[model samples]
Target: MSDSIVSLHEPGRAVLPAYVRALEAGWSPNTMRDVAPEQLAAIAADPDAFLFGLNGRGGKIRLHDGSEVDRLPGIIRWIIAARGPESQFVGSINLRWQEDASGKPITELPPHVLGHVGYTILPDHAGRGYASAALAAVLGEARTIGLPFVRITCDADNAASRRIIEKNGGRFVESFVAPFYGPGERLMYRIDLQS
Candidate 1:
């Protein structure tokens, strides 16, 4: 069995070599864009900054399409599935605590984006159930925050992601064209937190 555990990114922590491995192996974040070597070096030197940037605490977010969005006032937690407390990083999950302007938990997500939770496992760590484990752990956090349900979206052709969502009790909602990302129709799945 894998010894992976999912936890929020911590500051001042040692940079896991697995991140370098992923980069060296050409695994970028879900954004699917290449990161500069200097930036990678900076991340390894201070992973806390990378986590902060991910959580929106550092300011804007640069998307894969080269668009930038101002960080909204919501809990953007970055969860990492690692082999152990001090092991390589296997995968990452982004758990966004959905809330409205009044800070109340929002059940429905904005129509533009894909989902409340997004995850990706390294190529070397594929087929190890890391995605499902990380998704389950983040769903627990969603329940803790009083979210009724969380929406997840994936490309219609991603059989692996479809299986992962299905294994975690995701129910099929509908298939819609994701105009924001591209022209392809994406599958939407919802997991009721209260269940």
Candidate 2:
């Protein structure tokens, strides 16, 4: 969202105010353990978490998801982030990825890919261009962590998410279905940070 801001949590420490508020609002924390081994290690070392709208006891609860829980089917664990006006932490996004749809395994980190970009913003944060902002934040994190590329997977039906990925300079890589998940076609996009 324009005029809104997001902030990165301090290394290995939770922003108590935002975190407690999110929990009081019925939010849970996600762990990278939900994704892959490498992802888990990364999250563990960095402790990436997000919080949003915890600005007060109740200024009108905006929205909170993905930050506490892995909205993505393949996500094992994740952290929370926050965003606000005059602040700089408004949305939640993750650096995680799963196997390629081609049945090829990604047991090890790829030199060109940091992981997948999974971003989510609260309802109130939507429509004001917050999604792309969160995505940009994640990209910065990727660069800081020395990642070269990232993947983004979206449900074929979610045009909104697809648009967000496109706005982040994602290129159409393929459209396929994930195993044991469902018959729904998924759009996989790739963005290279090395450029």
| Candidate number with greatest lDDT | 1
lDDT values, one for every candidate? 0.69, 0.50
In terms of lDDT, model 2 sits at: 0.50
- TM-score (all chains, Cα) for each model: 0.79, 0.55
lDDT of 1: 0.69
